[model samples]
Target: MNIDDILAAAESEAPDTRTVKVCVNPAVARKRAALLEALKQAKELDAKASTTEERLGAAPAPTTEHADRAQAELEAFDDEVLKSLITLKFTRLDGERWSNLTAANPMRVDVALDRNYGYNFDAVSKTAAMLTGVRLSDDGEELLTPEQWDRLFKRLSGHDFRLIIDAVWTLNEYAPSQHIEALVKGFGAA
Candidate 1:
């Protein structure tokens, strides 16, 4: 009803249940809004271009394609420069523990582990068990079965699987970042 009641209600909610709202400085907020609008416009234009090309069976303009490629190359270089790779070297026993965990679980724990990133440090590994779950299929309609997952896991080499294992472990320790998230899931999609 009043300011005091509103404050009380917010406090009463569980910390995890609380809805966080970040207020950027007004100038920064304006810039962010403009950037978002530009991103939307760019995406729409790309979609239109793709549709036109598909319908016409025509190639994209060479200059436009070349520019896009150049920009992508610059962005990739920037990403590489900004990111630092972390290699988690483990002894045989530790490696075995990691491999065993991966054999049993999918990377479903990413979302939960991410929640613990900035706040709860203690409940990481405990939550890692949650990774043993399902992923949406190519159609995003159904969950993959355990057998399906086992087959997929079997296809991975030791190095590929370990990359996943390290990525999962790092998620528990570090504050969230896109680079870290990419390590777990990869560049875009499978």
Candidate 2:
């Protein structure tokens, strides 16, 4: 072999630095570019949203007037609720009165307790037919109409809520030691 041939055989080949291979269809090239642009925009939007969320996380301080008004209203409602709880009376002993109260106006309990704490309507209705309906006994002597029962039950629920609030308020606002002593004496808590 000639000297030139020997030199050529010893030389390293250059790397291929080319980016394009076979040319893509124009439509395909356009779609790929559009997709890349959309991806860039989506990333930018995500960044903006994160910044906005950070800004929204910190709340402004409340005004004293508004705060005082809300507290006063809540306290007044609690006082009234405590009174209602003290006064509510449930009388179910008189047969004629119970009949009058329950049987006069028929009431059907449509909405029922959700599954979180109690059974749904389908399960409860199967056990107690009267839970889903209010009807008269064969002998018609009534105590309260269905409407009356509804109002009475609503007031009873209000009383329950108020009493709970009053209990909490008494413990927190009154003498803690006295409240604890009363609770210990009354409820026999260990």
Candidate 3:
């Protein structure tokens, strides 16, 4: 193996990336969850109605009507949810840069002269810095500043904020085996 070829391959490697959909409003999220459950029930009902029709040679009117109504409601609510969802893309930073950023935002431990008192991860600050350049739009535009990220974290429900944080962390720390598995699946390899 030529040294120059290895150097080129390393330099040309693309960072791993992940995307997450976030619904910031707690009410909307709850409603969406309910609608999804209802939709699942409707599908089961529809399947049963079809089977009944096949077996009896007569369609069940009430079951079909209920399933149709449930499907319509789900479709309308899905449109609303789509309008409110914010899609965030997270890209991994290269090793040296990632190391530097984490080093600069160390989790501090509080200690007395005699013994250890406590430790603070300062998660908000650390996460904000780690995600600064890593977070982007679907179109590859930078999404938010640190201040904006802080404000978003404050405004979002814990569940919603955690979704974004998880995406960012996963992209940065995902295992090579996972990547290979994904590629294998893409190629339909057993």
The model with the greatest lDDT is 3
- Looking at model 3, report the run of 10 residues with the lowest lDDT sum: 113-122
| Candidate 3 Cα errors over 4 Å, as ranges | 37-62, 108-142, 174-190
Q: Evaluate model 2: give its TM-score.
A: 0.23
Model 1 has a clash total of: 0
lDDT of 3 by residue, 1-190 (tens): 7999998998898766666666756677788789878878887887887788778977544456656787788778877776667666666766665555556654454434112212222352236334643444556666587686666667677777767666655554445548778999999995
The sequence of per-residue lDDT tens digits that candidate 2 reaches over residues 32-67 is 455556555655665566566667884443224433
Q: On residues 28-130, what C-alpha lDDT tens digit does candidate 1 reach at each position?
A: 4444455556555665676677778767978754224434544454555443332322122221123355345444544444466535343232232322312
What lDDT score goes with residue 119 in model 3? Answer: 21
Displacement of residue 50 (Cα, Å) in model 2 is: 0.9
Error of 3 at 122 (Å): 7.0
Clashing pairs in 1: none
Which is superior by lDDT, 1 or 2? 1
Q: TM-scores across all candidates?
A: 0.24, 0.23, 0.62
Tell me how many clashing residue pairs each candidate has: 0, 8, 0
